[model samples]
Target: MTPTHAARLVRELSQPLVSGAFLAARDRERLLEVLPSATGETLDAFAAAAVAVRRARIGDAASLCAIVSAKSGRCGENCAFCAQSGHYATNAPQHPLLPPERIVAAAAAMARRGVTRFGVVASGKALPDAELESVATALAGIAALPMAADASLGVLSEDALARLKAAGLAAYHHNLETSRAFYPSICTSRTFEDNLEVLRACRRSGIPVCSGGLFGMGETWADRADLALTLLEAGVFSVPVNFLSPIAGTPLANRPVLSRDEARRIVVLLRFLLPDRHIRICGGRPTVFGRDASLAPMAAGADGLMVGDYLTTSGGMPDADRQGLRRLGFVVAQAG
Candidate 1:
């Protein structure tokens, strides 16, 4: 398209009347036209537009989600990007699944801190029936809490998914990690389709799926865009954009980290594309944006955030996150 046409398209996108098709395509020429003109004022304009979009779809209310590393380390698959998998010699804490009491206590603590969604994450390819039963038992203890329960137990069987759903699991998280074309380069032990199957299993069991990708792991911009579009196609209810942390002893340890501006740019671009989905700022937030930079994401259309500490890493405290949201004039929404 000509420069004039591109400029016109960008203006059209900025307006609320544009069709969904235009946003879905997210034409590069249109983005370039507007991005070049994005001064501080334009950035705020974009942010305001994103907030309006988010409020219309999911409301101005933000949700705080927390996760517990129930089962840590000794993972079989060698996903070159992960720090917790046993395949990498990183000093990630390794232990069997925490006892049910500990899991229940963690859930209760998160509730006390105003977190409405509780997630349990395990590191491995998939869980056996015994392991699934263990997770189900943990979910049962916290059934009384108003918080919504979710799990990230790797690839799951039909029976496992059913049992978790029956135990009141509300959502399931299985990251695509990256685009299918680039997935093999990062993980050798598992296929991209294996992850897709797990998401499909979640859907089959009538649970909402929360799937997303990690950025800055030696992927091209096209790769990042492809990952976003893939998640859109997969019907993911929540998208957690995690930047690569490059932990010591991992294959990507020497890789350069992403700047906070670049991370925010991706979040803004994702808002333009997935205008109605829950876009969360997940792992690597503290290291990338610093603790003070939390509200920049909420201003850029992020509707949810992972609260408390992340797996094997310390994030900001829950009270601090709540304060940040309040300072920005955002009200934390309780999970239904």
Candidate 2:
């Protein structure tokens, strides 16, 4: 594509987004088709266009959120990138669910650091009835902290999600991990439909949904675009973009980490596609960019971040994340 063509396409696609409108279906399809061919200065133009939309639609404040692995390890699913799967023998921690008070205490510490959202995450196909009750109790305490109470407890029914909602659950997270066409290669224990069903249940229960994909697991640009479109179709409120960390003993242990440019491109693509959603940089930020450059995603169009430790990996300290975001000319959202 010529420079003129690339510039025109970027403007055509980004103008609607900057004005708080969506592109027509054909124009959106054209964006997915054209972006893969964008290179050199052309790609830079697309990135800049994404930044414009982000600034206009989402503003300059970067949101900070944290998650606790309330229950770790012993997962039955065989997602190839996870360290907490029972199919792997990695050194990830394993334990039953933590008590409600302990979970609330973790949130309290993060809240003090200005994190406005706290997720109670567990590693399992689905939490048992008893464990769900415990998580519900924890959700109540977390809600009292005046922070958003979120969870990623895997596939759950509408009734179960409504129970948590009544207990003050604010959002439900269940990542699609990747696109439907590429999903079977990454996981076989569960179908792609299962992931969608959980997100749908979240919507039916009136809980906001946080769903996204993991990049750098050998997916194509088309796969990334498809995942973005899927999240849009699912009507998720938040899209937590995670790159593959390639944990040891898992099937993807040997996969190479995505380069900084490629990771930025992923964020830019998601920002353009889901301009109005919360595109939060989550797991694999440190793995892909390291601490010193952790704010690169924000510069690329992301408006939110998952600060502190992740499920099975250490992450950038909250203080550093706050400082880095400030250096990037973005205001950090504080707990209200």
> Top model by lDDT, which number?
2
Residues 163-268, model 2: lDDT tens digits: 9999999999999999999999999999999999998888878889999989999998878888998999999989999989999999999999998888888888
For residue 293, what is the lDDT in candidate 1? 83
Worst 10 residues of 2 by lDDT: 327-336
Q: For model 2, which pairs clash? A: none
Using Cα atoms with residue i matched to residue i, what is each candidate's TM-score against the true structure? 0.91, 0.95
The per-model lDDT (C-alpha) reads 0.79, 0.90
Instruction: Point to the candidate with the largest TM-score.
Output: 2
lDDT of 1 by residue, 149-263 (tens): 8889988888888898888788899999899999998998989998888878777778899999888888876677778788888889999988888899999999888876677
Q: How well does model 2 score by local distance difference test?
A: 0.90
Q: After superposition, which runs of candidate 1 have C-alpha atoms over 4 Å from their true positions?
A: 1-11, 16-29, 32-44, 333-336
RMSD of 2: 1.7
Predictions: Cα RMSD each: 3.0, 1.7
